[model samples]
Target: MVDRKLFAGHAVRRMRRRAGLTQAAMAEALGVSASYLNLIERNQRPLTAGLMLRLAEVYDFDARTLSAGEPGGGADAIRRRLADPIFADLEIDRAELEEWLSGAPGGAEAFARAYDRGGAGTAASDAPDPGTVVRREIERWRNHFADLDTAAEGLADELRQQAGDLFGAMAERLRVKHQLSIRILPLEVLPDVRVRLDLHARQLQLSETLDPPSRVFALARQLALLEARGEIDALVRGGAFTDRAAERLYRRHLTGYYAAAVMMPYARFLRACEATGYDLELIRRRFGASAEQVAHRLTTLSRVGARGLPFLMLRTDRAGQVSKRFAGASGSPLVEGPGLCPLLDTFAVFQRPDERIVQLVELEDGSRWFTSSRCVGPAGGWSGAVRARFAVTLGLAAEAAGVLAAARGLDLTGGATPIGAGCRACTRADCPQRSAPPAGRTLLLNDRETGVSPFGFAGD
Candidate 1:
């Protein structure tokens, strides 16, 4: 087999510009001629192993940065975006996409942004969904904010929480520092509201209906708004959100992240995670947090140098409507798009309420994931009214299953249920649970014979 050449011209040029080095200066540092360096920077020449070693030695460069434009990275994102049905007629090949991504990454990113904004020709009245924009931004960062984690760790230390009584500590801090009194009002008084902050009265009112863990989360959210406002605002401003609604929504999300970080405090939580083998129930009890909160926090353990398992989380209601999703470092396509495979245990857990379901499933591409799903809260309220209940699923790559308690004593290789991203993106012809036909395929209507799948399509 021949060795593949490394061509990261854009990254090399960016690094040089960021270092404020002239072509000749950088070339001399890398022990290469200026003309050769220029050729490498222009993609006319590929960087050899020796040059790459020199780059690492001189600039402390990470070789993996060169793979950003490769198939499974940024180029993959462009490919997935172009896979949308709207671009079906374009028939843009991989070679063209790789060339575009390497040649003008900014233009490629702009194209992605346009696609995210519901296409370039979207009318003024047809504003892009604010929630979609915020979700994309969160996914772009892989739901991890290092600065927020640091600030929250500091705040958690300052709180001096004892026996994991974070709610009490936070309430005391609000009373002492912010001059905000905490009051638990009866459900009859605050029937519909769970938390109400009266600025004029200098009081934070929480409904008695909220469970202990939820109460702590609510208090932490309030404290985050008061204490981490600057950090949250900085993150929101950095988002460059054109829609004020999206900006506000993103601000709320950042505050929630900060709140979780404060409650779980990165170092302590990571230690607990490692020690417990990521047992969600045990960790929730230890931290005085809800199952959903624990699962969500698991996704945010993406700190540099000291990272935990790269987990992806998804929360959905009985109707299969997804309410929350975080892709984390794993970047599973299952968490992306509107559709989810009905066959995944995420939906099956709803059948067995309050019980944790662990399943090893293989996607269409043969990638396997170990998933744990359980039903989360529907906070107490008037008995006559409807309450919301959701199932939360936390999953990681199956290769790392050995590290998780949930995957213990399970067959990792065999007995893996074959799954797909969703009905539209899936090509599983024999899947009986398919709710819709795969996209870009002609429906096969056989009057005489019926297949296992209700909607048979003509394809491979």
Candidate 2:
């Protein structure tokens, strides 16, 4: 049937297939019977407005494609379908529908899917924050990297002598076996450039857009992908990819870990970090990485036998916007999920440049962990746009405190602040910024007993 209404149905079918969901499952999510939802997909029924909003709310689907004419390449059939009873009295324009479809996939798909599923009168929900999405993506990669470490550890002896220069060795292997040329160019001339792997001439061109340190880093990344294909495959095969988009994200993430491993050379970096007592600045200078980069690399030292303490690394701007986070050995369960401890004065360190070190204790699930935080400035010209208060933090469990190199001087056990995940999830009843009560706590607002803390939760 040349039903214009079926256009959105087709999109839903495509997305559902990509998401690996069966029709009955999608129907349940839409609050409709499987047969009814199937009819809408088959263009037997017009999708109402309510159903559109529900789709957006549930699957995080784009809503723009709902009102667009018949889905797919059959434009003429869609136009005929649009002219049916559904649009006979309505003043809908096909051109407008096409324009909306071409631009807003997220909004459209949400609307059509929602309407087809019998959405209530509720309004569509807000799109999720991109920062949150990116953070979650990073956490997934961190786990994937851990797997790579395990595999590499098993292959250590076979690759021992070649470990330090594995990238170089891999590149040479590729060149000798595949007849490829590797060249590095300067950063100023090729800013934002990266390695280009050419299959035609079998050449891998490294971007000159980086310094000598970075040139070698990029080469190593290329070599990792080429030489360690089996390792990479093992890491990726465990993931359930719904679409080409997610697969592409996995590949890009893999390339990044490879690049980091190339520059840091896991074994060498770990030894240096141990010898130097984990000095952030010293490591940054030696590895030609930014302060944030250094902290990130430090957390990844858990490759094979040289596992670092499960340290949680976070970098935030003066405004408390977290730029990056890495979960080391501590495996702080909070790494992948939402909610941050607002009282964890990591952000304040940026306010005072000379005051390099500050410590606080956070209580998660009744267990206390000591966290050390500091702000570091960016290298290069002072006039650069980099913020002054870029804070980085390292935390160690109270019980496992002595193992850390830095925690050696501090008291093994001490009194500390009882912090919670962000203000909403925090049980601290005295916090002024507590907009919403915590998940399972009663806020007692006694004028005489109210403390200075923003939210004051009675101590258990």
Candidate 3:
């Protein structure tokens, strides 16, 4: 018999938590009741191989993680070991007993508890890569600025008036410093003339197909990196680093941040933003920037002492893939790392081209943010393809005041919904897509009926 007693419950619990499924949610997906799932999770029920396999399939966990025992201790040992933890009142002694319990639920829970408190910070170098850490750092800054947009507005106004030609001068340097070149061909030439980089020569060449306005932006992004490499490095130097791959990822991430900052140049952009009453379109026109570029730059207002209204900015295609995300005030709430917000109805907007303003949704642990979204694309001239297929939104807490409420326009606080990535850190009970219950909640069922959401918000 395989000793599958080592922390089977612990492993299951962890996987369930990470998957963001509540016991009821998991039970619904697994075709079982919440109580049965709770039994398996609490080490009260010995997990059968068939049931174990089912869990692995349903939750996307590796089979090895599901059957937790000492190295090579088969499934039975995993079960027995986990069951041993609840047998504290029982008394038995054997050489194998110690080995069996060593890898059991009690031990696994201890390790997890330690790790949660930051005691176990190291992971082996060969661990599978989680690609979003560096990306999340960028999102965090975007959120910071979004939260402070009002304050940053005052600063942006001052900088815009004062820093006339600084960006132009930087563009001039790109022409002189590296013999950089720009061209403007028809849109048909996009396939070949888009942009190319010659890393060895330290030169960036852009397609002649882009209009003069966009061409300037391409040039500016490249030049911005070259000019601000030092500042970029200084910012990412102290991050939680694991390997060279992470460092390089972070460096490229910083390049985009610097590029956006240079274009707006902080103080000037904030001043213009405020004077224009946070008019995103006006800023784009004045700066000759694309809507996406303008929104991105707007989110970077967190730098220096100035801040913006602190909004979350996301650009997604009709398909749910997120092309860009900027966090201006709060850090990204995603614990598993940043990706598309499932609730953001970007595709629907593409269907209704005339709806310039619509509400975007996000639900997490019961807190909902009602956001306004609009589409953007190249404006006028060079007709052939409709280049505008992007949406932009200004999100604020449904209950917030001033610009926040102004963006929503009507009072939407009545049923302020809950939306978020998941329960990894979510506190909402009314989320329909909730896959897991709140962290630390006991798996046992309570009498209260869960509302419409898959995971009912856990009562305080």
Top-lDDT structure, candidate number: 1
Tens-place lDDT digits, model 1, residues 347-416:
7776798689999999876889999999876566666777677889988888877878888898888779
> How would you order the candidates by lDDT, starting with the best?
1, 2, 3
lDDT, model 2, position 98: 56
Query: Which residues of candidate 3, in runs, are more than 4 Å off?
Result: 1-130, 139-171, 183-193, 198-203, 211-213, 303-305, 331-344, 353-355, 360-368, 376-394, 399-401, 404-408, 420-460
Error of 1 at 259 (Å): 0.3
Using lDDT as the measure, name the better of candidate 1 and candidate 2: 1
Model 2 weakest lDDT span, ten residues long = 68-77
Worst 10 residues of 1 by lDDT: 67-76
RMSD of each: 5.0, 16.9, 18.6
Better of 1 and 2 by TM-score: 1
* lDDT on C-alpha atoms for all candidate structures: 0.80, 0.56, 0.52
Put down candidate 2 lDDT per residue, 138-163, tens digits, no spaces.
44333326545434433333434564
Q: What lDDT does model 2 reach?
A: 0.56
